[model samples]
Target chain A: MASAERIGIRSDRDILLARQRGRELGRSVGFVATDLTLIATAISELARNIVLYAREGVIELRVVTEDSHRGLVIVARDHGPGIVDVNRAMQDGYSTSGGLGLGLPGVKRLMDGFEIHSRAGRGTTVQIAKWLRT
Target chain B: MDVPVLKQGPFLIATVQSALTDADLAQMRRLLIEQVGKFRSRGVIVDVTAVDVLDSYACRTLRDIAHMTGFRGAATVIVGIHPELAFTMVQLGLSLEGVATALDLEEGLAYLNARTRPTIARGNSPRNSAGPPRNGTHTRGKR
Candidate 1:
């Protein structure tokens, strides 16, 4: 899936803009209200993760179609302190810092597909996809 | 800048103007607690009618604000959560247990009124007798 839209997640304003863009693209892909929320909320979660942990990142949303399955794909990339324990990060209520640990796991539950790549000191990237008929 | 606050009798109504970032969220929390204290209000209505998305951070901020205000003896009610946004928030594993929700601003005010003095009984059936809801227009019948 090629990049349909690219958003830089640097500040609070960028996160907001990313949400708006994600919502629009979701709508363009014929996602209903709940699915739209899923798309936009996922983007916000990823962007906020960057701002909170890495301090900056990039969000890429793409339109993907395979056979008869059509879905929207979102990729969030951040170049900050990467996650040392990917499996632990995916667990519910397992936040590195002292807060409700619902960010990554929540995203995984919302999307139809999810993948995470990270390094200890390099960066991290999260990719998620939501289908229309699912 | 602080989120806009409108004083209504003993209740303070804070309409979130737009999607908030981390810094703005912190600032808004400070201002809201301060306003709640300064007004000595009994209830606070956080109208999130203009917001399009409620992320994890936003949900946490709202919950924290509710807790802090509750510490100050003010009841907080969140009003006008876009239906889609609400559905998604719940799906994202956000319960928002500390904060209460209403259909619109009017209902939020009425909810606070009903809970504050505990004298006038509130209406059970929701009418939603107001203009169109703001922001994405996803205000459905009830929560």
Candidate 2:
């Protein structure tokens, strides 16, 4: 049983580092290959979005376990022009920025539990969870 | 991600150096579509063999590249889709529809070579004759 955490430094490099942190932490928790892959994918998406949309942001990775079941929690927050249309962004073929607007919805589908909060001109925060054995 | 340039006959082959996740898909869309339109080439080979997973986002991106490249009068061949990833994509029931994929980079290059080499052999291609395709296992597709 192990526990660890990390914070993204609001830079492009930090996005990669955050994803690496997710893999490292997942391995520390003895996560199997499938679960580890899921965590890595989710973390990479969130981190990449932070760098792409916002000038900078932070990412938090935490391990979780319940009744011997283990998992991961990934939280990515960014200070950027918050999304004006959350619902539209979630649509598969819809993209305002025109770059493959699959960041949020894609990551949400990859992980087990997903949540988002954003306000215009304020900032955006996204949290994702991946179960260990799922 | 470290994408290495490999030369295969009349084609410029390059393996993707990172996972072809949603984020990467977004970037590649711009690079391969908008940017590639500015230049002319006989063909472009993108080896996604290094990728371990493929999702709707990544697949859609590849499809877009193929379409754009075709519009530009250049052929785009997506090579080296990992078997596991391929299975996952099929199982997920998400079809990319128009993207061409080979088993490995070599095979992909061969496919391109078969099409482009004839043109190059006639000195129509910019690259030289009697060359083979470049191969590298790069990029992630696990998302």
Candidate 3:
């Protein structure tokens, strides 16, 4: 089990750093250019969620290696007002800010694995992984 | 720093430099609209070739910026999107709805230029000219 590297998501600039770090980590884990960009964009969306929804948060990047499988994992954690409705939030065109509301759905489509946990008043944590083997 | 909205002839070119902070993004948006109003420019070319990342906010802002430019009667072209970013954006479901994109800065400028030039005066565009198409993308049908 590889230890995760943490990147803070406090501002827009922080999202840029998170994306860069995610891309670099994805590249090191043997991801193709397309996969690298996907991983980075996923991080960017998640990190911006922290800044936009919650005030701030953290992103943890780790590599997954199991037997013959290798992958990149991302964990986004935010301790802000949690989503009241996960189902509605995941809808493609649902946005509270007059946006296209493509963040959550798009992130899901990019990664090989996705999961989310949240408590109304507590916070939210989203974990995503992209496998290189298959 | 002021995001330079340069004027070349009748159009405007806004190049986003690196390390743009949240406040900087706001400033650029404000200044871009201001410059468009001040110069009454016909079209705008937003060059993001130097940009490496496109977050959710960045994506939404871009789409919104293009819309805003349209409201001012100025056509907009987004250029220099990294190939990877474009691919990822498509996966992200960010249709950008009504945005026009180009491969590079030159293509963007040419697209905008070709858009504003006298359309009917060219005598059917020489269908077989040796030169590159005046419109790189965003052609014929118009957004």
Q: B5-54 in candidate 2: lDDT tens per residue?
A: 55544465667877544555566656655444455455778888666545
Global fold similarity of model 3 (TM-score): 0.83
Query: Where is the poorest 10-residue window by lDDT in model 1 chain B?
Result: B120-129
Q: Give the winner by DockQ.
A: 1
Question: Between which residue pairs do clashes occur in model 1?
Answer: none
Per-residue C-alpha lDDT of model 1 across residues B1-40, encoded as one tens digit per residue: 4688899899999888877777888888888899898989
Native-referenced DockQ of model 3: 0.51
Question: Order of candidates by DockQ, top first?
Answer: 1, 3, 2
Clashing pairs in 3: none
Docking class of 2: incorrect
| DockQ for candidate 1, C-alpha atoms | 0.55
Q: Which stretch of 10 consecutive residues in model 2 chain B shows the poorest summed lDDT?
A: B134-143
By lDDT, the best candidate is 1
Q: Tell me the lDDT of candidate 1.
A: 0.85
Q: Runs in model 2 with CA error above 4 Å? A: B17-41, B51-73, B83-97, B117-143
- For model 2, what is the error of residue A51's alpha carbon versus the real structure, in angstroms, after optimal superposition? 2.0
